[model samples]
Target: MTSMDLSFRRSNLLRNQPIGRGDADPLPLLLGQLLLRAGLPTTIERASSRPWASALFEGRRHSIRLHFAGEEPTTQRARFIAGLSEAEWRLPKYFVADITVDEEGSDSEGQWVQLSALTIRDW
Candidate 1:
């Protein structure tokens, strides 16, 4: 098997949920789970409703940071890189970004809150 094939197999093992088979976004899912672990309500439709939203979502700033060990090919890593790249490309062309962070580092951390500011109004 090729290195890419081996990497993919390893990545899938680390995933909690299967790929392309969930109703909700993975990032949001993780955020919800984190909130629950912190004794906060996780069932809320909007993560912004929680107090943490203020810290994550400011006026208009979004950032995504990635941290990983030495350069070793893995399926999950490859998928993550590809997926995030796709998200970034689709972001500016199709979606509006209040803020976004695309960087790589060892000590990476970030937060994003879902705000209700943007909404469709009947004209």
Candidate 2:
């Protein structure tokens, strides 16, 4: 995976109070690390929410769209989902949010597994 520094908008501590727990800004970063550890060539791109999502869950503003590539598509997808499940387990205090992963075409690495995570800033 190529290395690059990416930054996202963080909620103001005193202003933007969250609507629920597990809305911290750290989930995506941890997710990226998980993808890397799985040995899948990956890239996490900071992204905006779907129009409908942005309208409904305005409080959860941070979205991360990560792409993973591997030789075996099924194995890689399973690994990623397992890692994400572990992450969700780590945050037992919060509600389990829905994360979406899809197959987005191929590159030099083989198959591209796209995962999007939407999280809220700490309030």
Candidate 3:
């Protein structure tokens, strides 16, 4: 009878080494990449019905508020609102968000629009 040596298998060492690209802010770039997925392109209007995003629902229920800077265009704001509702459109995760476009006020810098976002996962 031949004795099998298990030392070789035990000696095999592997580690989960995550390579880093040293990106300062990769969210925006990643979002742009997600937008390029091949299919019916994510238009400004048909945002809710796509496989990317869910329509945001606001009511008296489980809710949380998040703040994100918006752009200077109404159309752009709308696009973000829709995208924020789905996990696919907004890379990373998904939640129902009430996106309110704030008026350019004393708190806002030049051309920097503020969007008050409230996210609710479920009723």
What would the TM-score be for candidate 3 when compared with the true structure?
A: 0.24
User: TM-scores of all models?
Assistant: 0.22, 0.42, 0.24
Q: Which of the predicted structures, 2 or 3, would earn the higher TM-score when compared with the native?
A: 2
List model 2 lDDT by residue over 1-123, tens digit each. Answer: 897534522554456554334344445454545556556466655455431245434323334555555557557656666656446423322233555554455566555445554443222
Best by TM-score: 2
- Candidate 1 matches the true fold with a TM-score of 0.22
- Please list the C-alpha lDDT of all candidates, in the order they appear: 0.29, 0.49, 0.33
> How many steric clashes does model 1 contain?
10
Arranged by TM-score, best first = 2, 3, 1
Q: Candidate 3 on 27-114: residue-level lDDT in tens?
A: 3433344334311223211111112224654221121222223343344334444544343334233343444444322223212223
Error of 1 at 63 (Å): 2.4
- Cα shift from native, residue 113, model 3 (Å): 0.9
Better of 2 and 3 by lDDT: 2
- Clash pairs (backbone) in predicted model 3: none
Sort the candidates on lDDT, descending order.
Answer: 2, 3, 1
Q: What's the lDDT for candidate 2?
A: 0.49
